[model samples]
Target: MDRETRLQALSAFLKAKRAKIPPESIGLAPGTRRRTPGLRREEVAQLAGVSTTWYTWLEQGRDIRVSRSVLDSIATALQLNIDERKYLYDLTLESGSGATLWKEESPEISPSLKKIMNELRYCPTIITDRRFFIVGWNEAASCVFLDFEQIPFEQRNMIRLLFARKELRRLAVNWEHFTRGYLAIFRAYYGQYVEDEWYDRFLEEMKRVHPDFDHLWQQSEVKTAPDVLIEFRHAKAGKMMFHLTSLQVQGSADLRCSIYTPDPDSPTENKLKKLMERK
Candidate 1:
């Protein structure tokens, strides 16, 4: 992105983050009925230990050099989480070094990783690209989830399936809760890779097709890929729960392997086994 465009994006991101924080959260008393939703510009400048005019200029998308220490102070003032702080850096920093680890091109899975995935007969494992495209999967994954081969290659994205396919949503128990976390991670990725035009196109398509997507996107939630538990109401096997674990491929920075292990507390194993046998 050009300097001016990047500044504009940074401006929007800062405004969004600022709007979420309440006065009471930062030990500031609600002195009066505020004109704006969040902590005022003066309040943030005071908290961040920067001049209000300078901060205002920064927020206004002015061409100003921001130092790391100043950015750190602003991050602290905003109470940014790890992912959000990183995103903040990616936006303000000129080098864009924060996003250096991510590659825009499609990732290639190694033979060894493919072999390992295939060996885990009981575990439903699938590999996804940076955009959560289902690039690879095992027989167990096909059995547990839908047969990926049946779907068009272009429609293999996890987000696409979750929002577009009603059957998948129906199968997932507590779909909103599961998808919220997914969306949070996706948002972080989108912010870091703001230069990617594909993200904008995909986002526009999603907003047009799915009504709930715009609402979720507007929340500005950021999250890292943490282990999560998901329960699926299978038509044939009945109730099945799995603990989802995501791992980054060693050599491929753009790929993530998700393995679904049956929850010990539930009868997911036997049900999965029986379901796999039928397949």
Candidate 2:
């Protein structure tokens, strides 16, 4: 990423984090009315033991040198967790004046990987690249979600489907919850490909199409792959719950396989069986 973009990302992330903190929780009195949510910039500076001007400059994305201690203090003031702290450093510290390493093309799924996906009998599995393009999926996945084969190659992005497809969005019981985590994961990967044309194009299109997406993109939250329990309301099977797990492919760092396995002792397994039978 370029210095300017890196600075902007850092600023956005800091702002977003700051917005989530309540002044009273930090032992500060809830003062007069404010135009926005969370602690003000000056309040953040005070908490971090920095001058208001310096903190303001940082938020303004001004070109200035900052120390590790200051960054640490700011991170603490923002209540950032381990992954978010690492992300803050990645955006501010690792960024330098150089071209980002770009892949010539999207990573292709190897034959073995496809075989592995195909072998997943009961679980719904899907393979995606760094940009979240749906490269392959199993029959169970299609039966539960929309069939990837029906969508055009260019429109097969996971993020896009989550936002734009009404059927899929309706199926996800915790749509907002799932989308926020998904967007954070996407933002984490996006840091590595800020200058890639395809990434930029896809992002722009999403922003244009979905106002909610555009709003959330400004939050600048970053997350690695998530493993969590997700609930779905399938049309044919009623309510179902699964443990969503994501794993990197063995040979390809940029490729990932996400699987949804029915939760133990849940009706999801029986529901999935019925759904598959109907398929």
Residue 133's lDDT in candidate 1: 86
TM-score of 2: 0.88
For 1-279, candidate 2 gives per-residue lDDT tens digits of 556866787888888899989989989777788788899999999989999999999998888998889999999999988768877776767642123443545567788887888888789998887788888899999999998999987789899999989988899898988788778877776665555545566777888889888887777677776899999998888898989998867663467799999999798888888888987
lDDT of 1 at 206: 94
Clashing residue pairs in candidate 1 (N, C-alpha, C atoms within 3 angstroms): none
lDDT of each: 0.82, 0.82
Over 198-246, each residue of candidate 1 has an lDDT whose tens digit, in order, gives 6667888999999998877767777767688898998888888999887
Off-target runs (Cα >4 Å) in candidate 1 are 1-9, 30-32, 35-38, 57-63, 94-106
Error of 1 at 226 (Å): 1.6
User: Candidate 2: worst 10 consecutive residues by lDDT?
Assistant: 95-104
